[model samples]
Target: MNRRELREQIFMLLFRVEFNQKDDMPEQCTLFLEDGDTEISEKDAAYIRSKYEKIAEKLPEIDKLINETAIGWDTQRMGKVELTIIRLAVYEIRFDETVPTGVAINEAVELAKKFGQEGSSGFVNGILAKFA
Candidate 1:
C-alpha cells in the first residue's frame, strides 16, 4: 500500500493500543488486518503493525522526550491522537534510519492535519522540527 494508507494503519494500531492497552500487538494486528475496514496488503499491514509495536515498546522514552520537547505543554495535556502521532514520528526520526528525519516529521504533520484538532498540524510540525 501507499504511504498514506500505511500511516492510517499505524494510527489505528496506536489508537487501539492507547485506549485498550492491549499487549498482544502482533495477534491484534493480524486480526485487524484480516477483519478491519482498511484496504492494505499483508506485507504492508505487517510493517505498520511492527512499527506500532516498536514505538509502543519505547513509549516511555519517547513520551519523555515529547514531554521535554513540548515547550509550553505537557504530555498529559495533549490529546491522545496527537500524542500518539508524535510518538510514532519521533520513533521513526530517531530509530528508523531507513526513513529520513525530514520525512518522518512531515508525515507526522500530515497525520496531525488529518486526525488532530484545528491548528494541531502546526503544533505537531513545530514540535517535530526540534528533532529534525
Candidate 2:
C-alpha cells in the first residue's frame, strides 16, 4: 500500500489501542497487521507499526498538546474517535518533522471525513491548522 493507505491503517490501529487499552504494543501491532487482509507490503506494515508504536510511547505528551491546542474542547469531552485522530495528527506534527504540517492537517481532515461526524472534518482542520 501507499503512504495514504498505510496512514489509514495506522489510524485504525491507533483507534483500536484506545478502545482496548492493552499495553503490549508488539503483540497488538502484529495483531492489527495480521487481521487486515489488505495488500499492504511488509515494508509498509513495518513502517506503520513502528510509527504507531512510537506514538503510543509518547501518548501523554501527545494528548497534552492536543488538549492545549484544541481550543474550547477538552480532550475528555471529545468523542473517542475524534480524540484519537487529533492525537495521531498532533503526534505527526510534533514528532514527525518529515511530514509537512499541511500534509498532516490534510491527512487528519481526510480521516475525519471518512470516520467522523458531519462537521468533524472542519473542526479537525481548524485545530490542526493552528499548528501550521
Instruction: Give all candidates' CA lDDT scores.
Output: 0.83, 0.84
User: lDDT for model 2, on a 0 to 1 scale?
Assistant: 0.84
TM-score of 2: 0.92
C-alpha TM-scores of all predictions: 0.89, 0.92
Off by over 4 Å in 1: 24-27
Q: What RMSD does each model have against the real structure?
A: 1.6, 1.4
What is the Cα root-mean-square deviation between model 1 and the actual structure?
1.6
**Local accuracy of candidate 1 as per-residue lDDT tens digits, 57-88:** 88889888988888998788988888888888
- Residue 72 miss distance in model 2 (angstroms): 2.1
After the best TM-score superposition of candidate 2, give how far the Cα of residue 46 lies from its true spot, in angstroms. Answer: 0.6
lDDT of 1: 0.83
The collision pairs in model 2 are none
Runs in model 2 lying further than 4 Å from the true structure: none
Taking all chains together, the TM-score of candidate 1 against the true structure is 0.89
